[model samples]
Target chain A: MARIIQCVPNFSEGRNKEIIEKIVEEVRIMEEVKLLDYSMDKDHNRTVVTFIGEPEKVILAAFNACKVASELIDMKNHTGEHPRMGATDVIPIIPISDVTMDECVQLSKELGERIGKELNIPVFLYEKSAQTSLRENLADVRRGQYEGMAEKLKDEMWKPDFGPANLNERAGVTAVGARMPLVAFNVNLGTDDINVAKNIAKGVRASSGGFKYCKALGIEIKERNIVQVSMNMVDYTKTPLYRVFDVIEREAKRYGVNVVGSEVVGLLPMAALIDVADYYLRLESFDHSQILEKRMFE
Target chain B: MARIIQCVPNFSEGRNKEIIEKIVEEVRIMEEVKLLDYSMDKDHNRTVVTFIGEPEKVILAAFNACKVASELIDMKNHTGEHPRMGATDVIPIIPISDVTMDECVQLSKELGERIGKELNIPVFLYEKSAQTSLRENLADVRRGQYEGMAEKLKDEMWKPDFGPANLNERAGVTAVGARMPLVAFNVNLGTDDINVAKNIAKGVRASSGGFKYCKALGIEIKERNIVQVSMNMVDYTKTPLYRVFDVIEREAKRYGVNVVGSEVVGLLPMAALIDVADYYLRLESFDHSQILEKRMFE
Candidate 1:
């Protein structure tokens, strides 16, 4: 079985269309990689590029994109509403199929070493690839952003995981790690009762001690006169969308609100939907491998 | 988007492994066609081969397999528990994605014409591709099986939609048509009472005035000491597995029987599972195209 992995690399410069296209083109031209999506947010001044393929090919595509970003984007003059870290802000590698986080963590470290050694840029390992518990969270690793990174790295506890301890002013710092894919899903209610949405969100999100992998919020869709319980299911395998949606539907009944519908905001691993089918259809001995398209890939 | 269609061709003579492999290999080597599954039932003396690809490629592959089966399997020596009418008993073309039943019917007719013209094999169109309402059902088309087919063909009302009016003795007659993918699913009950299973089966099957596309029967599993409602969800799109299961769950409750479990036997189109997810999750604007594996093909 091939080691399929997904790489979503965030770059700091989103305002420049040419630069974003150039970086994205690197992934598109890779022989085995499929360029799933790439979006630029002018407000955040950041671009997110998503692609997937075999581990070697995916890592190659990710490295090429990082190289392009380092050449074109200068963090010294970069400005964005989102967190700032590197020209290639953060590259997170996720295991899609026939691969594990342990393999991804090893891949991430090797990728970090290559970027640090070859590109001569500082790199930090966060999430599953973190060397210490303190560096496990991305926010903690990117605490001071690009400006304070030079001073922050001078401290013993904050030493760079790979590459030079001193910051590379032009390329800035990059954080690479292994993590599970996240699903951005939202369920909309018929009524505009924001309290109903907020209450349901409170019951399902991790902050309030709900599903460990769930992060939810209440948002108003003003034009539609409806409220939505938007969520980020960090690990769908652990917290399936159907389970959470059913809970929200039952909870909405409590507030006299009916769940009208829901949306899967972006591309999701096929296994997530397969799990939903198994739950709803009460399928026995069902496997994702049984899907025809999946068999074609094999 | 790719015009994906599934072809399931049933052939006579399942006892010979070499002949079955030879026939199945015709579909295997076709460009762009995926040989999903092929199984032989010695008791039925039949080999059912399943494959999928674009409409044109699929038809071509089906033609090649039919030609091979016609050469290898002699209907004169064929014997099975299942009904049979030809060397290639039946060829069903089903729309999987970005294709319609109308398009599949057209493909079936075109393929039928070619097979009858080139292979010199008699062809009858049934189901969606049938020329008359009387020939709409496959059982109606294969009324007398192989032995009685020759005499039946002489009747004016029983003329085949394509091919010669007389049957070919060695090659026999074939029924080809366009139909939706069928899912052989079964729901088991905890109790051993056969009556409960039969009543629930009647409440949910098409013959009993339930779902229009579902055909079901209650069968006993002696070893397990349980009864099951086995079903053929012929058109999963029109009457999905989840809806039928829910009805069965409710009906089972009335009899104080719980739906212990369910099983999806054989290959089912990926859309069937996607529909289950859409219904259970109450997704808004959810499309099967959103699946990552589907996009890879596109």
Candidate 2:
């Protein structure tokens, strides 16, 4: 099976149609890589581009898109609701198929090195690709934003992983890392009681001593007259969907409520859903290769 | 999205390794098409080759493989436990992705025409590709086998669909058609009593006035000390896996038996398992495109 990696890069500019298209065009032109999605948020003044392919092809596309973003998006005049550090704010490489986290870390370093030497953009390795715990979280890496980055770089502990310790005036700085795919999942309750949803979310969220990779919140779906335990599943490989769903089902039963429905807000890995089937059906010796469509990639 | 079709063609020779390799080589060489699987049952003296690709590419691979089978296999000297009527026994075209049954039927006809005209093999379009009710079933089309094919062809009702009325003495006749992918599923019961399994099987099998596309039988798993309701789900789209599973689960409950587990014998369409998730999870507004890997194909 070929090693597949997904790359999601957030660029600082989203309002200019011409600039957005030009930046996205770099990824669109890579024949081997698929441009799964690219959405521009005018409010945040940011665009998130999603694509996947073989590691080499994906890295090339990510680099090309970052190059385009750095050239056209000048940090001096940039303003947005979302926090920012550079034109291409962040690039995260996620291993999808027949790939390992270690390999993705190496890939992130390679990409960071390329952006540092070729594009002259300061790059900080974050998440799984970070050299220290201080840089592991994206919030800490972008703590100062683009404006304070130059002054923050003067600190001995705030040294960039690659490029000059000083910030690039036009591009600012970029954060490159390796991480798991995030799944936006929500489970609805039969009752409209918001407290039930809140209790369940509190019991299941990481901060409340639930599944470590799950970040959950209690929300209301007014149209449906129901409450929901919405979540961002950061690492499905470690904490599967079935386990979380089962917990929510049992939790809802305590309040004489049923799990009316669930929603996957955006795209999720096929393996995540297959794991649900395997659990519900009590499948024996089931391998991912047993999925017919998976054979095409192999 | 590209229209994808799966083609499984059975050839008369199996014991001869060189001959089997030569026939399968035709499909393996086509880079655009994926050779999913190929297995030889020496007892049946048959080799079933499975492959999938775009309609045109799949049709070309099927035709090329059929040509090799006809040239290498001679039905006059063929002998096996399984019944046969030609060198290339039968070709079933199955719609996989972004394709419909009607499109597959047309593809089968195109493949049949080419085989008949170029390879001098009489082709009988069976199943969905049949022109008359009498030829719709494969067993009916191959009733006389290779030995009686020539004599049977003499009758007005037995005329070839795409070739001369007389059958080829060496290669004999071939059956080509379109059909849905069959899933071999088995549901195991916690109880050892075979009657519990048998009753459930009878309740779900089509022959006993159950699901129209289901063929079921109760069997014993001696190793596991459990009884199972094994099934050949002929059309998953029409009779989904979840429906059959639900029926079996309910039936087993009547006999105070709990469902231990289930097994999918071989490769099944990814959609089949996804449907199970959608049903049990009560997924709302879930589209097949929402699958991340599926986007790679699109």
DockQ of each: 0.58, 0.71
Candidate 2 per-residue lDDT, tens place, A1-298, comes to 2467899999999899899999889888997788988899999999999998889999999999999988999999999999999999999999887788999999999999999999999999999999999999999999989999999989999889998889999999999999999989999998989999999999888999999999999999999899999999999888888889889999999999999889898888888899888888989899988877777667
**Deviating ranges (above 4 Å) for candidate 2:** none
lDDT of 2 by residue, B126-174 (tens): 9999999999999999998999999999998999999877889889999
Clashing pairs in 1: none
**Candidate 1, residues A71-148: lDDT per residue as tens digits?**
999888988899888999899999877688899999999999999999989999999999999999999999999999
B-chain TM-score for every candidate? 0.90, 0.96
Scored by TM-score, the top model is 2
True interface contacts retained by model 1 = 0.75
The per-residue C-alpha lDDT of model 1 at residue A195 equals: 90
Candidate 1 segments exceeding 4 Å error: A1-4, B1-3, B76-81, B148-150, B164-166
- The local lDDT score (0 to 100) that residue B182 gets in candidate 1 is 83
> Interface RMSDs of all predictions?
2.2, 1.5
